[model samples]
Target: MKFYKANNMKPTVAALFLLSLLGCIEACAISLNAQKKYPYVLLGNDYGILNENDLGGFSWGFKRHPFNPKDSGGNYWQCFPREAIEITLKDTGSSADDIAWNDNIADLKIVVWVNQHLVHEYGMRKRLSIIDFERRFNKWREIMKKEKYVCLAGDFVNYEHKNENGIDMDIYEWLFEKIKTKKSCDSYLYSCHPTYEAYLREKSKEASYKFRGISHG
Candidate 1:
């Protein structure tokens, strides 16, 4: 009777072990899939998001008074190399909206820059702009070498508080309205403030265990 009971228990234990292994496999697969889908993970202070590329999609790089930053942000933009840009445009993966996701929150003008000099205004027109860009690119190449980054910069709206008679006023603009530029360029590289990153990691941990957080240790 004891032997019979042990035999039955063996099968039950084996079944449970197999189920657990399968569950682990599924979790691993999902993790890998997410990694592939989002090649670059931008870890924020309170949230983390995935992105296809890191060069020039949507950056919180430069900050200016809600009005003046737009011109500086819009004047200089960079993106992927010519081949990547061609592939992106061919696939119709690039969009003006991609340049600034918060356009609904504010108005902006941006330029797609191959470098400091070579540039084109990014527009979402129906026609393919790749060939036209190529012709001009080849012509420009005659003058200088090609670059490997796609960047955008122009007047992008930034919210700032102004002091008026000891009172603070919040300034903001809608996309339908134009943003004013600064007297000089004020663009900078994309960066994450340490305090902000720490905050994001803490928030992410509080939010979900599924997210990968920056290791302070």
Candidate 2:
């Protein structure tokens, strides 16, 4: 199990395009197999959900896709070809443990992408209580050990707060501290650099060219 701190770095357009092409090719190949095998599971917040229009027919790389439904708690469980699972946790009542414990997902690799809302909320709103939050955090720790789950991306609102802040900021800090001690977890801080600036410049040039073409057309 591994954990990674979130960063502002974005993949280059060329890289994204190449990945899409590769994914399409892989999907085609998987479709040919009669007995499918799923080895990857994507777990994250709503941002992880993929719509039909996002990748067209190759969304799951299979001719027949798995049933995607929202439970009463408003969480989405989408299973794709090869039995790959994509879980989107929208509400506090939803628990990933339920999906992870399923007999079908045994011995499979689970990849998690968590956002700030899962652990901390903004403004004066409270989504999960302190006790519940700690309980869920402990549950994840257990899942990490049992399922060998790797958290690829996650952001715990790391900031100082006072008692009146109305947010459980200390818990987030505690979570960060605990993960840092784990040998399997690696935490990092990203600062702006020249390379990122150059990437942005290139992206701007590409956008300018597209906009000009559209205007001329």
Candidate 3:
């Protein structure tokens, strides 16, 4: 597989990102025997079917069966994006449901998984300041240093700065910027675009927009 790097992105970081693809290949090899029965190994929650043509011919398996963390035997980890919490906290009214929702957000914790290995746990209650993000991001970097492969899968809301609900999504931008600027020979970071077409366009100037596709996770 050919890996493309942005003009500003470091070569080492781009190389590290290839480790993620290696992990996917390894996973597929492990399940080769079951390929007839289970063609695809669903990574994240089912959003919808992704067209192969849109993905540069890369196939991530079928989402025929619902993903269950328990069945993964420690391979699967749950991740809660900032948008999920923001949406839940939108109900500021004092209704019983609103109160329960707000309470859940207050106690929310996001578990990050890399190469099917648990890496870090971040709490939503922490201050969303730049300092906190940097500190947490650095901690993740440190943890990933020992790992050869990195695979991150989640509903990273990268379409807009704010969603239709008016919830601020600057967090995703901030995180992406951090990944873009950080220089690490042993660390890896993968930034998902809002759409496959957008990703292809960014990757190559000659990239053609044949069909619209879902955003990369």
Candidate 4:
């Protein structure tokens, strides 16, 4: 979750090719697997969701990934709203308890974060909200070393303000379209457990939980 950092995380494919020529098949394969396997985790404030990662390809709930702990590679990573991050609490989880799940709790929904900043939130009736995608794109494109997180609601749309219907077309563009387009910035959307431990520590204050309002203590 390094933010505003200048390090670049994009691994050059040409380098991968060179490794292949150098007989680094096993290592290269492992790296490629990391790139293809883990990216985002669908998690509420609950820990149970992550435990569901064992379900074959559906193994990204409440999960975490470590990207660069020792900076052996010394690079940056950015998440380009690649996809809408979706999370469901499974009826019971730490998040549910943390917020003191009572009928009066207003059904504190999910949150979206970029560079550890709150972007938007959703509720039971309006269980989803798309962020200002254009603003996000402009802010993140030059980041080159920041990770952005997008959250989604599997539930139907409902909002008290009556401003939400379900999927905001504008938000959809920010979340999906930008993903298809290469981010002008040098960023990488890694998994929950990132390999960069030191950076997380230094930037801990800047790293947003994305599950702030949940009662799942």
Clashing pairs in 3: 40-62
Candidate 2 residue runs with Cα over 4 Å from true position? 1-17, 24-126, 146-217
Which of the predicted structures, 2 or 4, would earn the higher lDDT when compared with the native? 2
Report the Cα lDDT for residue 106, model 1: 20
Against the reference, the lDDT scores of all candidates come to 0.28, 0.28, 0.28, 0.27
The candidate with the higher lDDT, 3 or 4, is 3
| TM value for model 1 | 0.17
**Best TM-score goes to which candidate?**
3
Clashing residue pairs in all predictions, respectively, total 24, 0, 1, 38
Give residue 57's error in model 3 in angstroms: 26
Candidate 2 TM-score, C-alpha based: 0.22
lDDT of 4 by residue, 100-176 (tens): 44322222232333222123232232211122222343344443224343212221122222224452221111111
- For model 1, residues 1-217, the per-residue Cα lDDT tens digits are 0000001111232342343233223322224443334322211110111122221223223221222323423322222233322211232334445544322222122222222222234332123334443443343333223433322222333434467677544432212111111111122332212234554666577767544344532
Candidate 1 residue-wise lDDT at 40 = 24
TM-score of each: 0.17, 0.22, 0.24, 0.19
lDDT of 4 at 14: 41
Worst 10 residues of 1 by lDDT: 1-10
